[model samples]
Every structure is written in structure tokens, then in C-alpha cells.
Target chain A: MTYFAGIDVGSLSTEAVIIDEDATMLGYSIQETGADPVRAATEALREALSLVGVSREQLHHVVATGYGRINIPFADRKITEISCHAMGAHHLFPDTGTVIDIGGQDSKVIRINAEGRVLDFTMNDKCAAGTGRFLEVMAGTFGVPVQELGELSLKAQKEIPISSVCTVFAESEVISLIAQNRPREQIIRGLHRAVVSRVWGMAQSVGIEGAVTMSGGVAKNRGIVALFEENLGHSIHIHSEPQIIGALGAALLARGEIHQK
Target chain B: MHITRKEYLLEQKEKGRRLMGVFPALYPREILWALDIVPAEIWDPPLEIRQAGAHLQPYICSVVRLGLELILQGKCDFLDGFLFPHTCDSIQNLASVIYDFIGARKPCYFFYHPKIPHGHTARDYYLKNLKALAAELKRQFGPLKMDSLREKVDMGRRISELLGELYDLRAARRLDASNEAFYRTIRKGEYLFPDDYIAELEGFLTQTRSEESRNGATIILSGILPNPPQILTLLDDLDVQVGHDDLLNGSRRLLISNEKPGDPFEYMAECYFHMPPCPTRGSSISDRMRHLLSLINATGAKGVIFNVVKFCEPEWFDVPNLQEELKKRGVPSLVLDTELNQGLSGQMKTRLEAFIEIVRVHRESITTKH
Candidate 1:
């Protein structure tokens, strides 16, 4: 009955997961990060704890991950989402070699080995063009829920190109297309194409190795996934709850610490 | 110990020594040292940048902004003049803005090193440039005596060799000094007189070797210059030893051992060309990659931390390509964009911690594998 908890407080959303000593996932929670990271993280942790009928005091350890990992006061450890994503993806897909994590703040391509150790990695250098934030900003302009961008884009008949690599410039391009009375579906397709293109450049930079796995909330975008797979020239393994993989990884790490002790 | 660097310069000036503000990259400090002129190397002045933002474009690097700010605020009025070496467009623009636009009282000295060596005249042209600078110094200060020039050249060589030894000791993981102590001790040359600076370095070398474990994660920092203090402190806090650096301020100048057997100008020219390939010098990406990898292997460094200056076009052009090369070689690196004197941000601390954790994990995994 010894349970471990992990929480990931990302810029756009927060997620928490719980696991038992046996490494079996017990429960998880996902919610918008909101303005207050502490509140968002605590609420998500409480929800995950409640799902397993466990109180906060019952947890053996609590590990935090993601951009706001350092802000989590109750956590026993703070692990980078880069490391957590690699760990989480490898946990679900043990054959994973390369893990592409496109998150709200930054995008990273990490090369993991057969044993789930990161070989080498690179992150988008202080630029927002190739990240989840880019899409979120685009979604706001389109008056669409960020989650529906993938599904909505899949309906495009003829995709137009969105050429700007910069987010602000691309937003202007999106506006011009909107003025030109272009179909929403086609524009969404172009936007997805742009995100995938940018992320693909990062993936190529790290170079593909073994079976690729996708992590972070962007993995929820079915259209972006399709584009990534198309450019990556292979199938990708994504967890059922893609957004919570980092949390799951953190929980697993927490369990490992317990066993060591 | 308590006097500010500026105060030290004023003291030297009051003693009738000429003080010149030297800008970034590839200046023959020996020339000034020979002339009894204290070249106050101005990379990053620890002044609050209030008015610099109004004049400089937001896209310009902080080095240019702060350097220009130091002059614009009239803090550098004590300086006899400023020497702008051919470094980057930002620095070149700053020179023009100060000389051509501001029309400041003190004369500005410019040394244009040929970007590409074309023929036999390349060395001659460089020698001419060096002699022209000397001639300019004579017109302003006095005649350059050969004996004083040779003595200062000797001093410069001694200092370079001492620094080179320090670098070697650190690379071998035998240096007892902390990261801050090591860099701060080396950078004392920025303001300290050669005799005093060399004495301090000599003092440091007495405790050079130690039986300390080299097992901690070692990294090479590549950048234009090191500053803001906190990053060095953080590296030490993380138990990460900076084994060696390819920084403009660090090994770039000290890399060429001062063993050039020739006249002063030729020796200086040799040192200039032999500086470990800088992108500002128009070195190809491949050359930079080779030099970086060599440092990595030599130091047993686990990774490289590219502490690039923000908006530095010269460094930026080479970083992505160099990073790609590192990735291809399966070497890990973290690229950071930093401004001068802007202390480490909270997010930056987390990132540094994560990078260190990654190195830790990678090390543990390696040992476990064996």
C-alpha cells in the first residue's frame, strides 16, 4: 500500500500521477496550470491522491517535474521534464531511443539509450516558434480550444502553407488568411504543419534513433503526431495519457528512491 | 583589496601612468604594458544599465550596450582613450557611434586585423597595423623604447605561461582552487598591474595540485566572456568543476603558449593568429567544433556549457552548428543566452540543476554498465 506521487506543473497545464510500490499506476489528474502554480499543483495532487483513496500523509514520496518543478514545496525531488520525459517514455515504451517533448515553454529532443539513459539532447534556444505555446497562441486567435486543434485540422481538404518561422509573424499570416476567407480547417492544417515542421527540425538536430516516442501535451494533437510520423518516416509510440507521462516518470523515480532506501 | 577597479585605475593615473580602455578580442596587451599604459580591459563594467537602453537597439548584445553605456554616462572620462579591436559588428558599430557620432573628447584607436590572410603581405599588413598603432601611441603618449617593449613582452610571456599552467593543472583535475577563485584570480588581469597580477597567480599556484576527486561532472564553458558571478557560484554549488574554458577572456588569449621566438611584433602576431578559433575571427564552424571536441576529450569533460551572450551575432552564428556537431558526436551540451551583470534567473537555476542531474545520471549509468 506504499504509494508514491509525482506532479508536473507545466506552463499551460498541470498533471499528477500516483503509483504503488509495485510500479503499477494507481491514479492520475490533469488540469490547466492557471495563474498560481502552487494551487494548481496542490489541487492536482489532491485529486490524484483522492482517486486512490489515499491521504497526502500516506505517500512515501512526492517528486515534481516540468517548468515549475522548483516551485513545488511538498515535493521530495524536482526532476527536469527532459529527464522525466525520457524516463516516462522509456517506462511505457521500453524500446524507445529518441523522445521528442514539445512543451509549453520549450521543445527538446532527447536521445535515450537501450537502458533509458539520455545519450545527448538539445532544446529550442529561447525561441517560441517550435513549442506548445505557439499552438496555444494560435488557438486563441482562431477561437478554438487548444485541444481541438488536432481534430479540427484533420478535416482539411487542401492544406495551405504557413511559411513564417516566427510566432508573431505567423499570427499575422494566420490573420491575413482569415481575412482572405480561407477555410478554418485548411488554416488549422497549415498551422499543424508549421508546428510539426519546427519540431521536426529539432528532431533531426538530435537525430532519430531506434523507435521514437512522443511526450508532453503536444502528443495529444493527433494531426501534429501524424505530421511528425510522416516527417520522422516511422511510427511513434505515445502513452495513452501523453500529458501525464512526465508525472508518471517522476512517480516511478520516487518509487526507485524508496526501494534504494 | 577593498578599492574599486575604477579607483585602482585612478590611482595608477594619478601616479602619471596612462590609462586606456581596451574593448573586446585580440589586442596586444604587451604593447600597452610596454608603454607603461594600463589598458583597462572593459568587457563588462558592473554599473547599472539605466540609459544604455535608450541609445542602443534592443537587439544589440549587452556587452556593446554596457560598454557604450559606460562611456555615454561619462564614467570613462578619466580614460585617456578607447581601443576598439576588430571583433564583431556590434563592437564596430559602438566604435563608430562613439567616435563619429558622439564626437567625444578623447581620441578613439582602431586596429583592423585582416579577416582573411591573402598573401605574403598578410603578415606584413598585420605588422604595419601593429606599427601604426604604436606610432599613434607615440604621438599621444611618447616614444616606444625597445628595452621597455622587450621587458613587457617578457612579462606578458611569463603571465601567459603561468595562466597556461593553471589551465593545464585544472584540465588534469589537480587544481585545488574553487571555480570562483580560479576565474576571479585569472581575470584579475582585467585591472591588476602585471607584476601584482602575476604575484597573485604565483600565490595561487603554490597550492595548485590537490588529491581531490575529479569524479564530479566536468564541463568546458565556451563564450565571449564570463560574468554576472552567480553562474560560476552555481557551477561550484552543483559540484560541477569547470575543467577548461574556450571563453574570449579565458583560454582564447592564453591558448598560444608564449614561446614564440621572434621580435615583439611577430610574436604578438603569432599569438593573435594562434588564438583558438573564434567565430568572430571568421573561423569556420568545423574548426570551432574540432577545437571544442579536443578540449572536451583533453579535460575528460562530461559536457560543454555554451554561455553565449545574448544578441551576439558572431557567437550565435557558430553555436547552432557547433551544437549540431556535438550531438552528432554524441556529446551533451547546454546553450545559454546571458547578458552581462544580470544575475542568474530562477528558471536558469532549475535548468542548471537539471543539466547537472543529467550528467550525474549519465555518469552513474556508465559506471553501472561496467
Candidate 2:
């Protein structure tokens, strides 16, 4: 059976996904992209291949994505995370007409068609206000793990509003709220709401169509997803592992290219 | 090609030619050429804003900010005079600041072009303004000789014809030029004397003409000006060609008239009236849409890219409507908010690349159906 590999090296984390000829997912791995993206990509690919019990030579093709995609020398092709996220979301949920990918540094709202081709899209400018980085920095300010902020936010009785659209200014706002002895969970919920509002503005610009799909690390946060669903006025599709969708899309594209050849 | 703008201007000054520092969009270049003056257009000079901030507000566009900064830096000290066209509110305000506040020693000339949807009165107003500018220049320089003005107007018309031909060839994909090389050559006209600029364009046409169409996906660039020229390099690398432009610095300024020159001022006004629609000139949204559609049909462009400058009120006001109209017509477009001289960041690159991919998909779909 033929096999394919997809590696995605982002600003904060790296991911790798392996698939078979039938496009069935074999396994995947996620790692922190510490300092060296190339090393992070290599190790993540190795761990994924080992978990699938496949050798590097046995993989028919390797596609790399994300901002660090250009550093992966061994990959057959480098595609932008924008296209990859759209394809991945469409493959996972065929009804996906719009995709909101809130990644580490940037956020994108992509409008896709039935065949997973991008129709139109909008992204947050060179700012971290509407991205995963915003939440991570807020979590750092609260002296809590970034992964736990979402769970903490779900317990909030009242949601305070985050007025600042900048990450630095928002962090200051969070610290001021903390100084005033505000509830931590409420502040966290406000942060989530702020992110939702920022990304929702982009969604409106693209004019959301059909069903929406949430991808990227931010999609893993239940609080953010719930707020997005509330704003979208509809439920969105989310995979079990939201962070691997970009790599999954890349792997599927690699397999599709092989068949075309 | 070998001489820098400074070197050429210095040489012209030594040769007793007056140089006027002209500001952005829609002006009578033939009038300047007729008066034996070379207009050094001040659009996007690559200089940091050191002293300009003190004189202007933070919200003003960089085109104005940088133009003011160049003056503050004493870069225009050697120029004979300055001309400010009534292009937009920011420029009009800047003109007031320069003439009233900063008090530069040189004489400042103002040209007011009529907004669109005007009748015969507007044309009369434009002609009156043209004569006013000429009479104002005569006080500082010598008398405006009729024969000299007529000859310079003819030279300006030749320059326009050559530029139009080059644009036609590129739209037909029958030109062997990358986006960077093409813009670099065309932008030389901003400072070159009319005779010398005509020679450079004629040389370009003779050398770059191709019987076979070039290979690439064609697109139209609509913007104030193509600054941070790295976009052109990036497009060339991606095998995308800028087939035509609606930029204030490019085709928006071209005179597409083939009629015989009657009166120089009247001819210039006719050319101005016939040029492409622009926001600075108060063109209606429908008129702009019709003009863009005609360009798209003529060039077979798959997409349009509005490379807008950050904080540009005129461009920002029109972009949403233009984009919406294009969308309704089944044409895809991308809007990039950019600042002058700030090269493409990683985020901008990703966005540009993804948009190109979408355009490629659109092209393939059309090809399959045909």
C-alpha cells in the first residue's frame, strides 16, 4: 500500500500526519516548535512515521505547510496554511462552506466551494489580537496553562468585556482586572469573547456560506468554539484533533497529486 | 538607465532647465514641458518620517507624509518651484500647510481639475485653471511662447502614444517584460525630460516586442501607486504577469486620445476627460466598474488586486464598492492594505500566494468548461 506524509511547522507548534493510499489516517504527532523549525519538523515527522510503523523511504510523498514550510528541504511541495486548512476542513466535513482558522500568529476566514477550492477569504492584519497568541499571552498573565484557560472560561458566571483589540493592551487590561480582584474565569471568558468578536468581523467580511468548520489550535478551545458558534448562529464542525487538520489536508493533497500523476 | 534621478535633475538645472516638484495624481505635464520645466513627481520617496510628523497629523496618508518629509529634509531645495494638484482632502490640507504654515520660500502653484459628472462649465473651469497656472509660471520664469508650448504638447502626445502602445502589447501578452522591469522603466517618466522619456519608451518598445504571447496568468493591479515594488518581484516569481494597471501613477495618467492636437490646453483637457475613471477625480462607482470590466475583457485577467496604501481616504472610500461590483460579476479580487516602502511581510506574502492559488483555480475551471 502507498503511504504519504504531511508536516506542518508553525510559529508555536509543529505537527505531522501520516495517511495510507486509501486516505485513511494512520497516525500523527504534535511538538513544540521551540527555536529551530527544521528540527521540530524532522522530529515530528519521525515520531509520526514510527507510530505508523512506516519508514521514511516507504512514504511515497511528503508535503510541508505552515509559515515554516519553506525550511523543510525534503518535502515535495510547500503549500500555504490558508489553502491547507480549507482543504482539510472540507475533507473532514464536506458541508464546510466557510473555514475560520485561528492559528498561532494569524487568523484567516476562508470561503470554500464544494470541491474544497478557495472562493474568497480575509485575514487579520499583522496583529496577534484575534489569534491563538492572544489567548496564550492572556493565560501567561493569569499564571495558568494556555490549555486550561478554555476550561476555566466555561465556568464563568458573568463575562466581562475586553475592550482592547491589541494583545499587549489586552494583557494590561487583564492584569488590571486581576488587580481589582475580578474573577479569573470571568476575565478568561472575556478574552475568549474578544477573540471571537475579532475573528467574527473577518467572517462577516467574507460573508459566511453553508456550514462553518473550526480548525487550528484555537478550535481545540471549547469556550472559543462555543462563542464562535453563538456568533455564527450555527454549529461548526470540529475534528477530534483540531491542530492536525492542516497536516491532514497536506497529506490528502499529496495523495491526490500522486493519483493525478 | 545609467543616470540616477538626482544626477539627471542636477544636469538639467545646470543646463538652465527649471524643475517643479509635482505632487500626486492628474496634472498637466504638457504645460510643465512647454514651459521648459521638468516635473519631478513626489509620490513615494524612500525616506523615514523624521520632521514631517511635527507639522502633520498622525492620520494623514504616507504619500503626503513622505512628500512633506522630503521637503523638510531640504531634498527639494534646488527645485525651482512646487505644484499641488487638488487630488484629495489630505493633499489639499497639505498644500495649505505648506503655503500658510511652513512658509517655504519657493512659489507654490495649484491646479484644480474638475470632478466627474460635470457639464460645459467644468471644462471651461479646467481651461481657465490651465491658463491661470501658465500665467502664474510666467511671472517667475519668462513669457510663455506659443510655438514652444505647441512643440512641447506634440512631444507629450508622442510620449503618450508610445506608452499606450506598450500597454497594449502587455495586455495582449505580446511583451517580454517582467512586472519589475516594466514598472521600473515606466516610472522613469516621473523625472525624465519629455524628449528623453520618449526615447527611453521608444527603445523599450523596439526591444521588448514579442510576436508570441508570454506565458503566465494575467491580472490587473488597481491602486494609488505600485510601491514596495517587491510585490512585482514576487508576482514574477509566481509566474503571474501584471497585464494592465488602473494605478494613479500608471494608466490613470495616460492620454489615450488619437485626435489631432488643436489647442494644447484643449487637447490636454480632452485627454484628461477621456482617461480611465479614478476616485480622486470623483468618478462614480458604476463608471469605475464599467471601466474595470472593459479592461478585464480586453486583457483576459483572471483577478484584480487592489494594492491600496494604508490611510488613503480616496482609495479606501471606493474599494469596497468596486470589490462588491466585481464579486457580483463573478470576478475575484484581493484587497491589500499596504504602506509605502514597507516591503512585503511574511503575512502579506502568504495572503498574496493564497490569492494567486484561488485565481489559478478559477482559471482552470473556466478552461475546463470551455
The sequence of per-residue lDDT tens digits that candidate 2 reaches over residues B229-340 is: 9999999989999989999999998887878898888887888888888999888898889999989999999999999999999899999999999999889999999999
lDDT of 1 at B363: 66
- In terms of docking quality, model 1 is acceptable
- Per residue, candidate 1 scores C-alpha lDDT tens digits across B65-133 of 889889988999999999999888888888988899887689789988877533456667788899999
Query: TM per model?
Result: 0.88, 0.98
Instruction: Point out the worst 10-residue segment of candidate 1 chain B by lDDT.
Output: B114-123
Error of 2 at B187 (Å): 0.6
Give the best candidate by lDDT: 2
Q: What is candidate 1's TM-score against the reference?
A: 0.88
For model 1 chain A, give the 10-residue run with minimal summed lDDT: A117-126
List the candidate 2 regions with Cα displacement exceeding 4 Å: none
Checking candidate 2 for backbone clashes, the offending pairs are none
lDDT (10s digit) by residue, model 2, range A1-261 = 789988888889999999999989999999999899999999999999999999999999999999899889889998888888888899999999999898999999999999888999999767898899988889889999999988999999899999986999999998899999999999899999999998888889889999999989999999999898888787989999999989998998899889988
- Measured by TM-score, the strongest candidate is 2
User: lDDT (0-100) at residue A39 of candidate 1?
Assistant: 94
Q: Chain B TM-score of model 2, please?
A: 0.98
